[model samples]
Each structure stands twice: as structure tokens, then as C-alpha cells.
Target chain A: MDFTYDDEQEALRDAVRGLVGKAYHDYEQRRQAVKEDPGFSEQQWARLAEMGVLGLPFAEEDGGVGAGPTEIGIVCQELGRTIAPEPFLASVVLAGGLVSAAGTPEQRAEVLGALAAGERLLAFAHDEPGRRWGASAEQVTASADGDSWSLTGVKEPVPHGARADLLVVSAALPEGGTGLFLVQPDADGVTREGYATYDGGRAAKVAFDGAAATPLGEAGLDVTASIATVQDITRVMAGNQALGAMQTLLKATTDYLKTRKQFGVTLNTFQALNFRAADMYTSLELTHSLVAWATMVIAAGDPDEVAEAAARASLQVSRGGRHVGQEAIQLHGGIAMTAEYSVGMFVAHLTALDHLLGDGNHQVRVLSTKVADYDALDPLDV
Target chain B: MIEGRELTKEQIVEAQQTLNAAGLAVPHWPEEYGGRGWTDLQRHIWLEELQRAGVPTPLAFNASMIGPVIAHFGTEEQKKEFLPKTANLDIWWSQGFSEPDAGSDLASLRTTAVKDGDDWVVNGQKAWTTLGQFGDWIFTLVRTDPDVKKQAGISMLLIDMTSPGLEVRPVQLIDGSYEVNEVWFDDVRVPADNLVGELNGGWTIAKFLLGNERVGVAPVGSTKRILARAKDLAKETSDGEGGTLLDDPLVRARIVELENELLALELTALRVVAHSADGEPHPASSVLKLKGTELQQAVSELMVDLAGPASVASGAGDASDLAEWARISTPTYLNLRKASIYGGSNEIQRQIISRTILGL
Candidate 1:
């Protein structure tokens, strides 16, 4: 029932804020980091690992700090505030989460251990060329030969795929249902073509031509449900990240309104623009509330409920992100249109996050199907 | 027994007495002042349960607005004289804050109360006095010192509606209802003892009262009730294709989006309530008013849209064989436009967010 973070959570927030904020406080630092290949700072990722953030969501035995969703959400939000291009969500939450969710004890130990130590980077290659944010893989199919497995298909726009040392790939199985497999980027018959995304991040079109693969957990078993659940969890985490970026956009926009002058006075003098900024603040606050609530739903640990909560949160974040993002740039006038300023970058990241899991319309379609199933939605009841 | 209509004064009084007997009338006040000493969450639950049970709430001028002000700033005599009666609706109160020129800028109100011996002669007009016909007394803000700043010269006074030289004239609205009125005072005399707080301190009291007004104005539970009922109504209304309106994809999508937004608003209300402790209001309270009113208006608009052609027959009597809900839909929607307009218009709420919250 309490929304205020406890002292320890507050400390985690301050620690993350200090690290990420220090690295990305100046916009040029993020610009410079994203200007080259890999799209983020390797040293910054190692520092986050040293700070134990990479291990926040895993069990101690599995080489994680075993922190709750709220703590993990804190890290996401702090990273989002700076729009830090660290691939934390892509590597730690998405890829590492898939392994933690469907991986065997041995896999969890080997993968998460290396991940937490910053010794390796992993990316979730679930998104294929034709598939649109679905949990199951259609184009990619896995084949088994005695005690070995190989994957053949193409997964386009795999976030950080080229940079990742390991790839957690979802593929259609011969027996039935979707199964998860692990593949190395440099495995034989695997090719990765890296490119820059609009949001100052890296993605790759990975072609797997009979690439060697190992089953993430049980062989030939359907991990579709597990994949969906992990995606749901990642969706909630993405919401937290969006909240962080929106907060910064609002702060930066408001600051610009106060300082940036036009004609005879500062921008804040115009009621029309201030009113628009006010709407942005409202959007941010509403998104923030839902994000916090959805994170707690994840902390509650019910898979179906987590999925629904994630959709609800994603819907809000999608809508709010657009309202805040577009208005942020529009209110700031020409400066926001350029790469030298931070507001436009925030909008780009928001646009990216909006579609990363599911956009507002997509989430709405998901929710609309079950609209009549409940008499009313009561968040506290659960 | 009735669900969703204005209650007669007797019904309201009886309901108030029933709630007061159970100590549920004013749970947010101090226990010494007839409160239940409930937490904010409990108070929220109380309101939600009341709405779900189809019970008309206790008079807001008493339970929410004036009751708290009296408890916080009233003399012991004022508390003793007002709290018990206010809780039981023995004294139905009406608000007299808005004037023709002072709707949003209320401090600029020209209502004058001149000191004349032990009585204050009041002269001015108040606009948009809601439910004043049922009010036994009116709480007013009057200018006592014209020489000082407009806000600094004001005072709050409790005036007996039966006083001499007072008039109440109903103002017809777009909905063709007389729910609000204009009350004029022609040198109406009031005993100086009726002043609620310090002279020239009414501005602070007005702000406090308005803050309370904004917090409760969300009507989340009531909106949820209406939305749920809308779903049922959608199921009953035919869509010309031999199927119910709810069968349409667009209809269902609209309902789902509204439901989700309402859910978000309700959760935001809960978050605001949970954080508003130790007497400091949460900054998000402004969002509650802004989005709360928007959602309220949205649901009402949806109801009208659902009504479609039947909405034009809003004035149809029961004999028309038209569904009562469809008949009332348009008026309800028109009436709800005031929800955003009153309670410190949504635009004012945005101003609060920008200046107070965003420091813009």
C-alpha cells in the first residue's frame, strides 16, 4: 500500500543515481558513447556490475543479489533518467531474465554468473523479421540430432545482438510449441550484421544457418509460457525505464521554458506553452503511478496477473510517453529538433521503448479481448 | 433505496443521521469531533463502499468542506454548535464562494460585510450556489476591509438563509435544471459571532476548503459504478445489426480504454491518499482533479454516445417507452460538464500543476 521507498531502496536509488547520473549528467558523454560501435560504455557496464546492479534480480546461488522488483525498477528508472545506453534492459533484464526463467541450474550459474561479473554480454534474440512482438518464434526453427541441437532462421533487430557474447534465442520446435535455446554469436554458421538504431542503440540482423544451440532448460518442452511471462516482466521493467526518461524530459523542458527566451520574454511567459508543459507533468505522474503499481504486481509473483499488469502499465506508458515526448520537443521549439540537445534524444528513446515490448494500440487490443471478463478492476484486491 | 439521483432534504437528513449513528459520517475529522479516527485508506474504503451500496453521500458542505474547517479553526463553541448538527444534517449548508466576477479569481469577490455594532451588514451577490434551495444556512466569504488587498480583506461568515433582505433565484442550466442559484444579500445583518475564523483570514480558509473540494471531486467510485452500468447498458441496447452495442469491436475498445483510464485514475487516487498523511497534501492531488474530472466527463460523454438517437429524447417522460437511462443520458452528460468547470476548473488545475508542481 505504501509507495514511498524504504531507506534501503532509497540508498539503492541514490547509489544508482550517483553512478548513472555522474556518467550521463552531461549530454555530450552519452552522445560520445553512442557515437561509435557497441553503442555504450563497457567501463560503465563493468562499474554497474561492480555496484551489484546486474545481479539485483537473481538469486544469490545463481550469482545475483536476489533483490525485489522494486529495487530492479529503481535501477531501470535511474538508467532511464539519463537515457543511459548501457543495454541493461537488453542484456541484464531481457536476456539474463530469460535464462533465469527457463534455464537449468547449471545454465543459470554459468550465464548469470558471467553476466553479473560484467565478463560477458547477452541479448534476447526473440524478435524475428516478420514477427511483431510475439512470445513465440515462427521464422526460426530448431532441429535436434541425437544429443545436440541446431537453429536455422533469421532474427532481425536483435538488440545488442552483435555486441552480445551470448544470445538467448527463441525458436519453433519440431515437436510443437516454442522452445528457448542458447547460441554463441561466433558459433559456426552464425552471422551478425550490426547497425545503429534511431535511438542511439545497436541492433543486429542475425542469421542462424544450422548454428549450434543448447536447450535452455528441458529439451523439446514448451517454454512459450515462460517466454511470455519473462517478456511481461521485461515489459514492466521497460515501463520503469520510460518513467525515468519522461521525468528528465519534463525537467529539461521546464528548465528550458524558464531560461530560453523569445521575442521579449522567456518561454514560460506564454500560457499556451506552460499549459502544455503542465499536461506533460500530468502524463508523467500518471505513468509513474501505474509503473510503480505494476512493479509491485511483479513483486507479488503471479504469472498471469503479472502479464495483465504489464499490459496495463505498457498501455499507460505508451500513451504517456507519446504525449510527454512529442510535447516536450514541440514546447522547446527548434533546439529540441537537433541532436545537440537532450530532449529529442529522450523522445527517441521513448519511441523506441514504446514499441520494444508492445505499443499502446497493441496492448489495448490485448486488454480489449478480456474487457468483459471482470466487473471492475481493483488493483488493491490482488 | 434509490440508486443514483439527488436525494430530497428529508432523505439526506435521514441518511446522514443513520451514518452519524454509526460514526461513519465524518471519518477524517478528529474522534473528539464525531470522527471514527480512520486512516486515509479506510476513509477511501468507506466512500467506495458507500458508492457501491448505492447510498447517497453525506452532504459535502458539512462532511467534507465546512466540517473540517470548523474542527480545525472553529471556537469550541463553534465546533459544539456545528459539528454534531453538521454531521447529522440538522443544518444543511451551501457554499457561497463564487460570484459573477469571482469564479476562478475568488479573492476578488465584491461581497461586502460592514461592521455595524455587534452585527455585520452584508451586501453582495453570490453566483452558482449549488443546492442552495435545500440549504438551511450558507457559508460565505465577504469583504470586511476594502482598504487592504482584496485577498487580505476577506472573512468567512455563516449566515442564516432566513435572514432579512436575502433572496435566492434559480438559474436554469443547459440541462434544464435548477440545481444551482444566485443568492443576493441586501444589507443582510449577521451577528459577528457567526464568523468562522479570524477576520481577514478567510483566504487561507478558502484555500483549505478548495483543497478538500479538489481531493473529493474525483468521484472515482461513482464513475466506476457508472462505467460498470454502461457495460450492462451496452449489452441491452441493440446496434441495428441484430446484436447488442457491446458486440461491436469499436464499442468494446472504447469501453476498455475508458475502464483502463478509470483504473489508472483510481489507483492514482489511492496513491495520493496513501501519501497524504500528517496533514500535508500530496502534490499529485492536482492530477487527481485534472484527470479525475476529465475521466468523469469522458464516461458521461460515452453514455451519451451509447444513447445515440435516444439521447435527443432526453426530455421524454416515462410514457415514451424509451429506456430511462438513454433518456437521461444527454442531460447527465450536459450536467457533468460542470464537474470540470466547478471545483476550480480543470484549467486552474493545470495552472497549479505547472506553477506549484513543475515550477514553470
Candidate 2:
């Protein structure tokens, strides 16, 4: 019932904000970091690990701090506020989340221990070239060769795929449903074509031609549901990240409106533009409410509820991100169109996040199918 | 009963007795004045539950608007004379803020009240006096001084609707309903004690009442109910192709979008209510009035669209075989247009958000 964060949560927010803000507070720092190959600061990633952020959502026995969803949300939001090019969402929340959710105790101990210590980077290679965002992997297939499993197929747009030391791949099992498997990027018969995405983030088209792999958990079992659930959780975190970016875009836009002038007056003198900024604020606030609620839903840890909440949050974030991102650039005029400014970069990151998991139309379809099952959605009922 | 527009005197009295006996009639007012001492969240839950159960809300003028003003600024004599009747609906109250010239710019109201010894002679007219036909009394904003600024010269007065030279003429709406009226005051006299607050202080009280009005005007619960009903209607109505209207992708998509928007609005309300402490309004309270009214109007529009051709039967009687819901869809859509118009129009809400919230 309470929306205000507790003292400890507030402290966590301040700590994360200080670290990310210190590193990427200046737009040039972020641009410089994304200009190169890995697309982020390795030193900053290690610092986050040192700060125990990468381990926020895992159990202590699994080499994580075992913090709750709200804490992870805090980190994601801070990262988003700066549009930090770090692969936290790609590596820690999504990839590390898949390993934690479907990995065996041994796998978790080995993989997460290294991940939390910043000794290794991980990427979840679930998206394929032809497949629209779906839980079950189709183009990627895994087969058993005696006691070892080998994966064959292509996973395109695998975020941080080439840079990741370890890959958590989703492949269709020979016996039945989709399963998670661990693969090495440098393994024989595996090739990665890494490129820069429009958002200044890194992605790779990974071709697995009978690449040696190990089952994430029990072999030949359907982890489709688990993958879907983890994706849902990731979707909620993505919402938090989008909220952070939108907040910054809105602030920057408003600040620009106050100071930026044309024809002897500041931009705020125009009611049309200021009104658009007001609408952006409205959209941000509504999205903020839903994102916060979805984080709590994840904290409650119910798969069905989490799935629905993630879709709702995704839908709102998708809509809000567009409104805020587009208007942010429009309100700032030519400066926003320049590569030197930060507003356009925020919009690019927002666009990337909007489609990372699922867009608004995707979410609407998901929700529409189940719209008949309930008369109303009561967030408090969760 | 669900409409709040169709409550009989007996039903209202019974509800007053039942709700007052349970101390639920006016849960947001001061405890000394029959409030239940509930938190803002609790009061929200109380009202939401009432709406969800198809129960008519306690009259807004009594439960939300003037009652709180009285509790905050009323003299002890005023409290003793008015609080109980206000809570129990023994005296129905109507709002008299908007004038023909002062719709959104309410402070520009020309209604004047001049002092004549122990009496204040009131003159001028008030427009859009909602539910004034059933009002036993009306709370008004009258111009008490001519020399000062428009806002500072105003005062709030409680006037008996039965007073001499007071006239209430029903104003027919586009929907053919008479839910609002124009009240003309011709030298009406009010006792000096009838003033709710200090002279030239009515603007502050009006602001307070309007803030309360915005918070309650969302009607999230009732809108949720109507949307749920729309889903049922969508299922029952056929699309002329063997499949139901719900089978149409576009129809279902629109419903889903509306539902999601309502969800966002409702959650924002909860967030605002949770953070609104010590009777101070949340900064995001403006969002509630702006988005809440839009969604409410959207749901009404959805019903009209769902009714399709059947919507034209808005005035049909029992002789027509069309479902009651279908017959009333268009009128409800027309009636709900007032949601964004009254209670501080949406444009004013945007202005507040831009100026006060965003510093635009």
C-alpha cells in the first residue's frame, strides 16, 4: 500500500545513483564508452560488482547478495537515468537471471560466482533471425551426442553475445519443449558477428554449428515456462530502466525549454511546446506508477501475476517511452538532432528498450487474449 | 442506484441511516463531525467498495465538498446544526460555484452579497447547479466586496433553497436529462452566521473544496464496473457473422486498451492517495482529474460504439426489445461529456500541471 521507499531502499538508491552518476553523469563519458567495441566500461562493471549490484537478486549460497526485486529495480533505473552503456540488463538481469532461474546448483555456483565477481560476462542468446519475440526457441535446436549436447542454429541480435564470456542459449529440445544450455563463445564451430545497434549498444549474430554445450538444468526437459517467466521478470526490469530514461529525457527537455530561446524568447514562451512537455510529464508519471507496481509484483514472486504485470508494464513503458522520447527531441529542436547532445541518445536507448523484450502492440495482443478471463485488473489484489 | 442520478428519497434516507449508523457516511471528514477517522487509503477503499457494490455514493455536496469545508471552517453552532444532517442526508446540499460567466474562471463570478445589518442580501445567478432540483440547501460563492481583487472579494454562504426570491429552473441537456439547473438569486437574505468562513476567505475554501472534488471526480470504481459490463455486452451482441462482437479483433483491442488505461489511472490514483498525507494534496493529483475524466469519457464512448445502431434507441421504452444497456448507451455517452467539463475542466487541469507541477 505504501509507495514511499524505506530508509534502506533510499540508501540503496542514493548509492547506485552516486556510482552511475559519477561515471556517466557527463554525456561525453557515456559517448566515449559506447564509441568502442565492447560498448561499455569494463572498469565501471567491475565497480558495480564490487558494490554488490550484480549479485542483488541471487541467493548468498549462489554467490549473490540475495537482495529483492525493488533493489534490482533501483539499479536498473539508475543505469537507465544515465542510459549507461553497461550490459547490466543484458548480462546481469536477463542473462544472469536465466542462469539463476533454470540453472542447477552447480551451474549457478560456477556461473553466478564468476558473474558477481565481475570475472566473466554473460549473454542470453534467445532471439533468432526469423522468430518474433517468443518464449520457445524455434530456429535454434539442440541435439544429444552421446553424453554431451550440441546446439545448431543462429541467434541474431544476441545482446552482448560476442563480448560475453559465457552464453545462456535457448534451443528447442529434440524430445519436446525448449531448454536452456550453456555455451562458450570461442568454442569450435561457433562464430559471432558483433555489430553496433542503433542505440550504441552491442549485439551479435551468433551461428552455432554443432557447438558443444551443457544443459542449464535437467536435460531434455521443457524450460519454456521458465524462459517465459524469466523474460517476464526481465520485462518488468526493462520497464524500470525505461522509466529512468524517460525521467531524464523529461527533465532535460524541460530544462532546455526554460533556457533555449529563439526569436527573442525562450522555448517555454510557446504554449504548444510547453503543453507537449506537460503531456510528456503526464505520460512519465503514469508509466512510473505502473512500473513501480510491476516491480512489487515481481517482489511478490508469482509467475502468473508476474507475467500479466510485465505485459501491463511493458505496454505502458512502450507507449510512454515513445511519447517522452519523441517529444523530448522535438521540444529541444535542433540540439536534440545533433549527436553531441544527450536527448537523442536517450530516445535511441528508449527505442531499443521498447523492442528488447516486446513492444506495446505485442503486449496488447498478449493481454487481449486473456482479457476475457477477468472483469477488472486490481493491482492491489496481488 | 448505481447511477447516483436515480435515488429515491426513501432509498437515500435508508442509506443515510444505514451508513451513518455504521459511521461510514462521511469517512473523510473530521471524527468529531461523523468522520470514521480512516486514513486516506481507507476512505478511498470505502468509497470504491460502495461504488463497486452498485450502491449510490453519499451525495458529493454533503460527503465530499461542503461537508469538509464546514468541518474545517464552521463555527461550533454551525457544526451542531449542519454536520449530522449533512452526513445523514436529512438535508441534501447542492453546489453553487459555476456562473454563466465563470465556468473555468470561477473567481470572476458576478453573484453579489451585500451586508444589511444581521443579514447578507444575495443577488445574481448561478449556472450548472448539479442536482439542485433535489437540494434542500445550496452552498454558494458570492462576491462580498467590490473594491478588492476578484478572488479576494469572494465569500462562501450556506443558503436554504426554500428562501424567498430563490428560483431553480432545470436546464435540459443534449441527452434530454435535467440533472443540472440555473439558480437565480433575487435579493435573497442569508443570516450572518450562515457564512462558512471569514469574509473575503471563500477563495481559499473554494480551492480546498475543488481539490477534494478533483480527487473524487475520477469515479474509477464505477468506470471499472461499466467497462466490465461492456465486456459482457460485447459477448452477448452478435457481429452478424455467427461470431459475437467480442470475436472482432478491433473491438477486443479497443476494450483491452481502455482497460489498460483505466488500470494505469486507477493505480496512479492509489499512488496519489497513498502519498497524500496530512490533508495536503499530492502534486500528481492533477493527473487524476485530467486522465481520470478522459478514461471515464472513453469508457462511455466505448459503450456507445458497442451499441452501434442500437444506440439510437436511447429514448426507447419497454416496447422496444433492445436491451436496457444498449438503449441507454448513447445518453450515458452524452451525459458523461460533462465529466471533463465540470469539476475544473480538463484544460484547467493541464494549466495547473504545466504551471504548478512542471513550472512551464
Instruction: Give TM-scores of chain A for all candidates.
Output: 0.99, 0.99
Best-fitting candidate, measured by lDDT? 1
Provide the global lDDT of candidate 2 against the true structure: 0.89
Model 1 whole-model lDDT (C-alpha atoms):
0.90
Summarize candidate 2's per-residue lDDT along B319-348 as a digit string, tens digits.
999877878888888988998887778777
Candidate 2 lDDT score at position B129: 95
lDDT per residue for candidate 1 within A26-142, as digits (tens), equals: 999999999999999999999999999998898999999999999999999999999999999999999999999999999999999999999999999988876787899989999
Model 1 in CAPRI terms: which quality?
medium
Q: Which ten residues in a row have the lowest lDDT in candidate 2 chain B?
A: B1-10
Backbone clash tally for model 2? 0
Model 1 per-residue lDDT tens digits across residues B60-139: 99999999999988998889898899988989999999999999899899999999999999999999999998888999
Return the TM-score for chain B, candidate 2: 0.96
lDDT of 2 by residue, A2-52 (tens): 678899999999999999999999999999999998999999999999999
